[model samples]
Target: MDTNLSNYLKKEQDKLNELLSAYLSKLSMPPLLNHSTKYSIEAGGKRLRPILMKLTCEGLNGDSEKVYPAAMALEMIHTYSLIHDDLPAMDNDTYRRGMLTNHKKFDEATAILAGDGLLTNSFHVISNAACYSDTEKVFLISKLASASGLEGMVAGQLMDMQAEKESISVEQLEEIHQLKTGRLLTFSIVTGAYLAGADSMILQKMERFGNLIGLIFQIQDDILDVIGDSEIMGKASGSDEDNQKSTYPSLLGLNGAIEHKNRYVKQAKNLLEEMELNGTLLEKLVDYLGSRNQ
Candidate 1:
């Protein structure tokens, strides 16, 4: 990664870690469940979802501090998804961020409840009136709910699970990602823009950018599973093939997957160019993602 991209990602991610620590510290829940929740929250991650949110807000001359709670909520939602995804009933993974996964570090029941806690708590964080009005909070919560619910992430996960039993076309794969990954990524952009009181045109542009960025990220993930290091990825490599699931590489071959990832990144970068907002960092971020192996 370029120095600028590397520094920016690290800086924001560190900030998020602090914010999450402060927020989670105040929670008074069951001991084991709370520990399970904090286990994954404190576990190191890219914090990419929250950073995407804060950057869009910063681009619009908005205060990131005001958006911090909502940004943290995004990360919580993401972390919950990862915890559940790593469960025995799901991907059955045993490691994340170079440590035992939630289900492994703690009992499966505790991990499952911990994921539930994070998912539901995200709405409360977004709906809080710390940084925005009730109307705006409602808008954020509504969008987030749809994105994380059956209409979006749930639908995508369902498709992924069902596809494990049979072949899926490229079109079906795209639809699965558009809901599963695209909605939340788009929500990251849209939520920040809504907080900043951005005009509808800019919101529309962000919507398009978010969708392409999601595809770029997911396609690259598929490519990495084939050629990435398990140590660097913090999980076993080639788990996709091991589970007999379809992936970009499985459907389109390694070369084709790389081409598609590049195409989507370029499309996202082009959208950044057209935005009136200064999205240099976002463009660089998109470009950087194309080469991110882990």
Candidate 2:
């Protein structure tokens, strides 16, 4: 993509940051809890999940502003995951999003509490919808909780931990990643449709599209970790290999991972075309994920 296009994305992401910060400020917490929560939520990152939620809502003819609570909740869940993922018990990283990891910047205990705060606060955000009906709010919260909880991201994390230092089949690897990484992404889109009151047919299609993008996103991360720059990626490079984790590039060669990501991108685009969607932001996002360096 051109620099102008990427710059536009950055601009939209900044809008999300502003909204998130405002909502976060309204929540009640102690001083230390507030500080730790702010540390991770305010940390620099792409904020892709919230952006996707906004775009998906727009595509469904829903008010983007009405979707802000769900979008913010999605981002909070994502931030919480990153905070925990960087813990010593997890990836044990010291850097994230081009800054010191939460544990590294704060003590490990503080980081853990920060992650917990974000995760719990996410539910609070989802529960109070300014525009959605009670039923719709419940639906959104249930879907998000399911996607971010035991059956989804958390389960995937457990599988990842278990698979470390051991070789697993490609199918098993994909299953682990689908739950660990893809679940929330899928929820990000599907929740938009649900909040928009989309028909079941459209919602199902959106779910498929989200799943494809989620897998592509994870595959790209695997590829980048092997070849990306630490300065650009904002974390230690080669950590996946250093930790002996099972990754797409480790199982499939670099070229193979590229091909695999392309396949998923194509699948996602085809699904979008089937829905007759006009937004290029999602398309651009898929392209960006396939081609991202960090």
Candidate 3:
């Protein structure tokens, strides 16, 4: 990563951590629910979604502070998804971010409620954010609901589960991830740009940019699963193959997957230039995504 980008990422991640802790501290949920939710949040992966949101806003010269609540909400939804994804009924993983998975650290029921609380509370945070107009609140809430609900990640998760242990074409795999992973990622970008007062044309292009970036991200994730170190990744490698899940490497070979990701990376950078965002943090971020280890 560029030194500037690296510093910015670390700074944003720290801010997000403090924001989450402060917000959760203010909530009045049950003791266990609060603890379980905080446990998962504190497990601490890259706060990619919120970072992307803040970066997009800053790249547009928008007031980054205006998006703080939305950024927090985005992270909460992301953490909720991870918590549920690690459940025994989902990926059945025992660890995440080098720590016990939510269900492993706490019981399954508590984990379930933790995920639920985060997901639901995300909207509450948005709706109550006084910075946005009522119209903006409705827009944020609706977009988030679609992005994280049945039309988005949840639907993608179902498709992923159904496709497990089954051979799927590359297009099919992309479709699964486009919903399951891409939507929320896209949400981070589009919402950030929209709140930054980007015009409809720019928003459309950003949406496309977001989708391409999402594909690039998922492609890299697929690549990492095949070759990543468990200690570095903070999760077991080869879990996809163990589960017989289809991935870029499984279908395209490792080299082919790299080539495919490069194609997207190039297109993403090109799209940034078209948006006149070349030489910006967003462009640097595309490079970071191409080479991310985890």
**Which numbered prediction scores highest in TM-score against the true structure?**
3
Better of 1 and 3 by lDDT: 3
188-251: candidate 2 lDDT, tens digit per residue: 8887777666899999999898888888989989888898888887777888898888889999
TM-score of 3: 0.98
Q: After superposition, how far is residue 190 of candidate 1 from its true place, in Å?
A: 1.4
In order of appearance, the predictions have TM-scores of 0.96, 0.95, 0.98
Any runs in candidate 3 off by more than 4 Å, and if so which? none
Ranking by TM-score: 3, 1, 2
Work out how many backbone clashes candidate 3 has. 0
Model 3 lDDT on a 0 to 1 scale: 0.91
Model 3: lowest-lDDT 10 consecutive positions: 40-49
The lDDT per prediction is: 0.84, 0.83, 0.91
Tens digits of per-residue lDDT for model 1, 1-294? 878878988988898888887777788887887788888999968887877887788777777667788888888999999999889898788888898999899889889899999999888777764767888778888888899898889888888888889999988888988888889988998877777778899899889888987888889888889999888888788889998888999999999999888888777777777775545676667877788978
Best by lDDT: 3
Candidate 3 per-residue C-alpha lDDT over 1-294 given as tens digits, one digit per residue, 9 for 90 to 100: 799999998998898899899999999888998899999888777998898888888888888898889989988999999999989998898888889999999899999999999999999999999899999999999999999898899999999999996899999999999999899889999988988899999899889999998999999999989999888898889988888889999999999999999999999888889888899988999999999998
Residue 94 of model 3 has an lDDT of 88
Rank by lDDT, highest first.
3, 1, 2
Pairing residues by index, what is the TM-score of model 2?
0.95
What lDDT does model 1 reach? 0.84
